[model samples]
Target: MTSSITDVAGIEVGHFTDARRPTGCTVVLARGSAVAGVDVRGAAPGTRETDLLAPQNVVERVHAVLLSGGSAWGLDAAGGVMRWLEEQGIGIDVGPARIPIVPAAVLFDLPLGDQRVRPDAAAGYAACQAASRSAPAEGCIGAGAGAVVGKIFGFHRAMKGGIGTASVTAGGVTVGALIACNALGDVVDPDTGRVIAGARTEDGLHLLDSRRALLRGDAPRPMLAGSNTTIGVIATDAVLTKVQASRLATVGHDGLARSINPVHTLSDGDALFALATGASGRTPGMMTLAAMAAEACALAVVRAVRAARGVRIGELHLPAAGEI
Candidate 1:
């Protein structure tokens, strides 16, 4: 098990990272259309076509789901995904042309990257062209390229955060998750109840509990006004109604709540999408899927932090600057 979202039969993962600019995008393309639903938990989410994914909406399936950097501005990447799907003769037949349904969400990675040079349509297209079924290149790549976490102590003390993914199969069902771990709060391991990576102490050593910092009412949130977010997608092989898929997304938030301290706040945009291919029989019930989803989500967060390499802050790497 490569333990990536691609473990699901039809899903393929790809990344287009602009290393020089410290920004990029990731695309999760389904070989065939998949039933999709989304849940937005953060107070400042930047999304596209999310409404269409609702149970009552007209769209039934999506060709691809994009998670990108550049915040709201990066939404244009979805246009490129649409173009790619159209060229492949995918999407709903609307007579003259097939309209590929694609939904996307973005995180604020501007603080670490060359904010002016953000992901664009061309970058998105490149990502699709690069799609593959192999294990996705995690860490500081794709939308996670410029991702930073634990900024409650401000930019100087934050740690590098990036993309992480995990997948599992049990009781004849397979579930997977891909996450871009950028947030305003600390990341805690649910199993250990320990702060793995987050705001650092003044000496640049030891993890500081940003949640406690907030409770003290002394922490000045870095780049407040929606400067942080975490976005990603989850995939399963089970069959589910749009409503069930939506609920899957909601329960998936428990993963974030367990892994990210003080999450879904006014300064963070945390969103997760659920896609079901129904490629297998003997699917588990919704509650079971939700529990597994939460586990995958939490594990993915830890993986993202472990895989990430610190970005430069002045003359020092962000991680080293706060090395405890």
Candidate 2:
């Protein structure tokens, strides 16, 4: 009867944060046996567990998945998850030794609030330990701690972006999504359809029309080379094979499109993963169910932006949803 995706069974999430360092990570673990798949649509995605997700990959089950800050450097955090899984005796065959498959992905967050701080291996393990059967915290925490958006014109004009999640259930199948929103477009209110966060002019006003800004030759704005991405995970309790899960992940991108404007840009890395815990066998239409899941995920992205608190970077103000 719950409206959110946490209604799915045996899917748990946890967050580990360091406010002083201003960086953290989150872990999503399948409480029971589950099949998972991933789809990377972005050109600059940074992932470590992708090989394990492919159909051709030898590994079957992923003990845990990590989403963290530190850009490419944060990728090392998987080592900590691996270490913990090894202690638990997970992973494919390797003689008497066991290697835990902990797939992880990260986004670039070095420029939003702090540059020196990054998510480390210990942080990853801490997050994994915190996974539980509660609704995961959203906005300005974990992998989204340093996220920002609307930086196509540079950070000075950008707005604060963070983590968001939403879920939906139909025909006894539940689908949930968790997203770290760090993109080049503005976040909008899904209900009212208004720009809630994004770039602003010096006079303190929104672009009014984002497409116009891209078309107008008003003034050539300096752009950051690689400082954007939105990554997320979608989980369902429907029985699905790895290939079907991967296809579902791709379908989840529709949620991204509904929440963010001008998504999947060259400067942005947008990726989504779909995980299936075999708790339901009520066979539903695959494409129809996937579309509904995507819609719910998109709503969650909007909620994430609405929940963010403003972050100050130098003299410029990175406004929150209300301010935008």
Candidate 3:
């Protein structure tokens, strides 16, 4: 019970954080490769190799999944992951070479950090070197280091977001989620239906409740397309086909909908990747797996905002959930 995605067998987690700025990348490695699929729910997304995960694609497995900061430029980090996996002799064995399939997604964090210092190939390799079966460090680290949420009002009023993980076991199978939440809307507690972290009021002393503001006709501050996003991975030990894995990823969005108000908006790029290692060798009921996926994803999302630490860079300040 590490309560982490690592709790799922055959899954390893790692991070590479840049001290120069609050931007980095997280890698979910399945060295042995695993059946993988993805669902991109938001209108704007920055990703690589996602099409290969489609059911009709030739590739049926992936060596690693990457969640990163620095927007689209961060996609370069995937190259490093491939390099590391190749060194381990892990990947699809084609006639000519063994190519590691590394799919990746990136979120917008350019404004909070030194945009020029985005995660590069070397950074990805470093993250792979740091990979471990141990529970990963959460909040204000890795890809979520510079994450911010509740931007409907504007960045100045937004709160800090971060990476979080949660796992659930049912019928001898385990499902887990690791989320880097950087949304354009507020985070809400699913149980209480209450806003936990979001845009601040005019005084910057209270939660503005983005959902309520929308209903009350508060004109939201306009944001550039693809300026925010929530990216994550869902892993399970149960046996699943590529189609099932994709469905799991799609249902995983229900978890996001439950905890994040006004999610899947045009300004946010929300994506989830599902990996089934089949370490348990159990073909559990699809309904059971889907329920667990959503539950774990929701828990991880809430934890992300709660575990986050406030950010203060010069005049810019993004408070953690508890800070207010």
Pairs that clash in candidate 2: 5-167
Please count the clashing residue pairs in each candidate, in the order shown. Answer: 6, 1, 0
Clashing pairs in 1: 204-322, 204-323, 204-324, 205-323, 205-324, 206-324
Worst 10 residues of 3 by lDDT: 219-228
Q: lDDT per residue, candidate 2, 25-47, as tens digits?
A: 87777745468788887777888
CA displacement after TM-score superposition, residue 172 of candidate 2 (Å): 0.3
In candidate 1, what residue range of length 10 has the lowest lDDT sum? 315-324
Q: How far is candidate 1 from the true structure (C-alpha RMSD, Å)?
A: 1.7
Ranking 1 against 2 by lDDT, winner: 1
- Root-mean-square deviation per candidate: 1.7, 2.2, 0.8
236: Cα error in model 1, Å? 0.3
Models 1 onward score TM values of 0.96, 0.92, 0.99
Question: Which segments of candidate 3 are over 4 A away from where they belong?
Answer: none
Question: By the TM-score metric, which is better: model 1 or model 3?
Answer: 3
- How far residue 151's Cα lies from its native spot in candidate 1, in Å, is 0.5
lDDT of 1 by residue, 1-324 (tens): 458888888899989998668889999998588889999998889999899988998787888999999988889888888888889999998998899888999988776646888888888999999999898988899998988888877777788899999987789888899999888888888897788788888777778788776778864656675689988899998988888888878878899999999789888889999998888854689879999888888888888888888767566467721244
Reference-based lDDT, residue 219, model 1:
48
